[model samples]
Target: MQVQFGVLGPVVAWDGAGDAIALKGPRHRAVLARLIIARRRVVPVFRLVEDLWTDPPADAVGAVRTFVAALRRALEPERPPRAPARLLLTEGPGYALRAEPGAVDAWRFEQAVAATATLPPKEVFARLEEALGWWRGPAYAEFADQPWVRAERSRLAELRLHAVERQAEARLGLGLAAEAVPDLDAHVAEHPWREDAWRLLALALYRTGRQGDALAVLRRARTLLVEQLGVDPGPGLRGLEADILGHAAHLAPAPGPGGAAGRVWAQTAAAYDRTVPSGARVRLESTVGLLRNLAVTGGSGLQAARRHRVAAVAAAEELGDAELTARVIGVYDVPAIWTRVDDPEQAAQVVAAAERTLTALPPGGHEAARARLLATIALESRGPLPQARRAGRTPSARGPQAARQAEEIARRLDDAALLAFALNAVFMQTFHRAGLAPRRDEIGVELVALSARHGLATSEVLGHLIRLQARSALADFPGADHHATAADRLAERHELPLVGVFTQWYAALRTAATGPAAAAEAEAAYRNAAARLDGAGMPGLEHGLLPLALLCLRVQHAQPAQAEEHTDWGPYEPWARPLALLAQDRRSEAAAALRKVPDPPHDLLFEALWCLTAQAAIAVGDRQTMERAYIQLTPAAAELAGAGSGLLTLGPVSKHLSDLATALRRPR
Candidate 1:
């Protein structure tokens, strides 16, 4: 009997006939997944209790044992009654699943990565392809939303990414860099922060006799390291760069950190006082340089950026150098989030001051650079209020055309910095001009490369946020959460103030859609986020806030106070007139008022509005209103049936729609 058990993506068992055997249920599937990841290592019962349940049941031990027993039966239906389990055995301390190496897909992938040393280049590539093919989705994709499962899946996903990185290296190693050039180029483009991959791409270029191209890669990498990280390239990379410059004959491919420790850490680490000559006394020039260096290092966060800006201001005042002043301000005036330090008004003031200063500067390259900086600042500091967004028809909103134009301009300029700036600029515009930017998710990947390659800290934060927004907009909640996690981590590590509000909004939406106490928490989060949204001054807040208020009302998370007789939804007053009617206890009028709403934008809010309308109409026994509303709402209703909160009501929303269809048909 040939059976394959895979935990590479979904936990599944398949027979030799190429059909998947069903594996189901929350707890049961989790138990099997844990065993597969455990990889025959004994997992203690105590560990299982904590991993499986946040608040373990009083009979948690009994439940875990029950789940394991069920899994054993599902795995081996022919096992003799009362016989000791052979495959899943209860060992001295705990339980273990004994399976051959090839049976588990994760183990196979690990093996392929490990066995590359013994295999030829083509063979290594083939094995990696085979290993990668086994993944049906994200590792333990079905269980990823579960906190316990998330940690393990993230670990596996990283391992999978490394495998891809290694496979690309193999392609370069096999003298196939010409064939590998396009892929390696794109790979490095998407993950430009990865110095090892950059090194590989450079080696590929040199091996292909494109020595000049190889030098260009190293120079850009070196510049990015100095500009973004405030550190020089590591010794191996520097040595390789030098050798490439000299057209060294022995320029062999050197792997990144995967090869050695020397490939990773910068060798420019000086012990102490070496530069100061044993405390002869530090000077103002050196101090200012350190402050300037602090501006570029990625992980130092918002305070570091501010410190550089302030110090540079003082230096300019003392020295009376206009160009130096502009350069410092230009570098640090990047768009970022703040907790409370710089609110909307203060940010507006900063923008005004910067504009005034720019007018005083002599027009030249400095002016152009200052203008670009001003554009970035305005993007963060001034745009539209939260309510300015509407998914209205627009012939000009097609995103790819604008992005391609910017891309072409950047390329024609032959400037990496300009290209990085263009990518981010185009990325921000996608949200503002919305025809539901197709493949918006891919933008995050390019931004990731751009930020890393050029050391753009704002792009790093925006890249993650873009993915978060794209994932949520698509209703891929699990993927959204993944991006949210990365965004939060980067925000904290980098001290990004602007990222907090955007991440908060995403988190609230996800929680509102699915949390156990969805209404109460989501309402609070959305209200706080609404204030921040107003502060952001980005377009779409008008459309964005309407949904939140409607959701809050629909969930009964926070009902409108009786004192509020009218809802001033700004330009959307006509479309939102029903909320005011409902708040005033005019349920009949509320149902009638909704007739003014135009065709919905075909987004989550579309479902929210119609569901609320159907509820209001039902209260008034307006069968005609219900029938008309349900016709437009049916498809969205069916898709969102299981989703809780006001987006689609929890109980039988689909059933309710069906029943209404039946009632409408039966009546005169």
Candidate 2:
């Protein structure tokens, strides 16, 4: 006999004739929902009573047993007297509900979702809709607040989200991108933290020709990441933005509503696969191409890269050439830095593995490439641009040297992409490991020229970003603002989502550096920048943004929602945590907290950090702490002595250390 049970929403049951069973009221419904949540496993009567009732009666166990009897009567109303209940079984100390696979809506929903896994595009779309149909409103809406039910609902919601993501992919794959937009929009609204959903949404927008809205969503996501999480955007999202900016051939749509042709990139993959000659060389080349496409194509970069890395290794082994394999490995090396599962502290393990793998490699392309790979890992581990730059001057710093090799090889091979990558390496070096960004105006100009010639939007945006920071540190106000404006404009115009958000942030930092007169304006701008930081991957926004950050602190008006963003700053928590307390009018506590924030070694933000401590201490009547902070400022006094006004716009690198030093040490 067919019995359809749906506990995913309200509890509903019907036998083969589709007639609703006369299940009693709320208690009966609660019993059914709770049992379904337990997935037919034996749930003890005492536990069920605790979870189902906020205030349990003295006879709770007997009450639950009565509810189970009502449930059994409802499940099989016509069962003969003394006939063992088929659906509800009384096990030791508890009861269980057992139904066929398709009987329960929640089980059917999962089954439908699992069925979509290996289906073709058309089938996937149909199955996804079927799975989505089970959600009548949150799973078990009546029991939404029940602690036991909450976990199940959360799991189902997450499952539903995954289903939505997959459904959107199917829609996009079939060239039905516009159809997926509504669901993705809702998905992101409900769950802003899932960057992949944002990525897919942005892509759908781009594919449907809504460039500005696409940029806005990316910016919005950035803001959430920054103001709410104090972090930068993920690489997959960044890569998507870059591709959008450059109008990457791969992202361009295949004509039609059904997406029967899929994305242009898919066509390229097929074409490339066909071009390779059948041999070990073919295998090696195909793997390399797949790695690049996966890395650049947005979404699933790491998983695809890992899979192909092994394939490349197998082909290299078959060909009997270690150098060839090392070169292949080199091509795929940067993925570790950008992988979705990346752990900043875990790079040393990867470095050790790479070193062992390449130790026997001859002094050729492989050795240099491995060194460059290590450099990327080192930079990635430090977290963000400035800190990474400062951290790179260690005894183990080899990225710069290896990058030089890549530059030479690219020049020899006349490869534009590799040359661009190598130029980026040079640019990375200009952040000046000493703490402040040193003068690198020449490299900025060169980057501008290189990136423009090759149509590299990411490079162009970065080039301008570098110029903007350098100009600010040099106290070139008009020039700094000009660079800032240019970067901000380009970031908006191009698909440089991260760069766009960063320009907005750094531009505000520049404004804040203009001093007291600009604080209010800069404060507003800083808030705007925070909103756009999700895609701004490089980090170090805190330094230049400090002036306005202080304004927010001083006024005791900083928003907790925004302050929550920096909670994961780890060791740098003190640098930002006091601002949170200050926002809540906890002055004395903030002052106490500031005293504990130590100056990191080789710290570029050293002067600014101390000055902030001094300012914060003054607010809370901590004269001794203020004096100690001012004393710490003395070391950088001479460096900024000759510098003009507005060093606050200067970053944590050597470039602006003098400006910050000069200003902090000025007579009271």
Q: Write the per-residue lDDT of candidate 1 for residues 1-668, one digit (tens) a residue.
A: 55578777667887665567666577787887787778889988888888888899899989888988887787776789999887788997678988778877878777777887688666888788778778888888778777666777888887877877788777765545555667778877777677887787788777665677788988888888889889888876788888888877566445543323322211111222225564222233344445544433333333464545455455554555555555544444343222112333434443444444566677755534554444334343323222112324231232234345546656666666655655564554443322232344686777767777777666766666666655554556787678778877877887655566666666666666664466767667667777765534333343335354543445333354222544446533544466557767887777777665554333324444455555555555768677776776554443333232112222334544655566566432
**What is candidate 2's lDDT per residue for 1-668, written digit by digit as tens?**
76788866777888887778777888888888877777879988888898878899899888888889888887888899889998889898888888787889889989898988889878898788767877777778887777887888888888888988998988887876666778899999989999999999998877766777788889999999989999999998889888888989888665555354444544444345447666646568557756754543332453455455555655665576656655665565331111112333243433333444566576655435554444443333333233333446442255455556656766676666555566555554432232233444565677678888988666666566666655655556577577667766775675334445545555666666555667578777767766564323323443234333443323322123134433354344565567567767777878778777765323234444454454455556565665565555554443321111122332222423333334445444
Give one clash count per candidate, in the order shown: 10, 22
TM-score of each: 0.36, 0.50
> lDDT of all predictions, in order shown?
0.59, 0.61
Tell me the RMSD of model 1 versus the true structure. 19.2
Best by TM-score: 2
Candidate 2 worst ten-residue window by lDDT:
333-342
Give the TM-score comparing model 2 with the true structure, all chains together.
Answer: 0.50
What does candidate 1 score on TM?
0.36
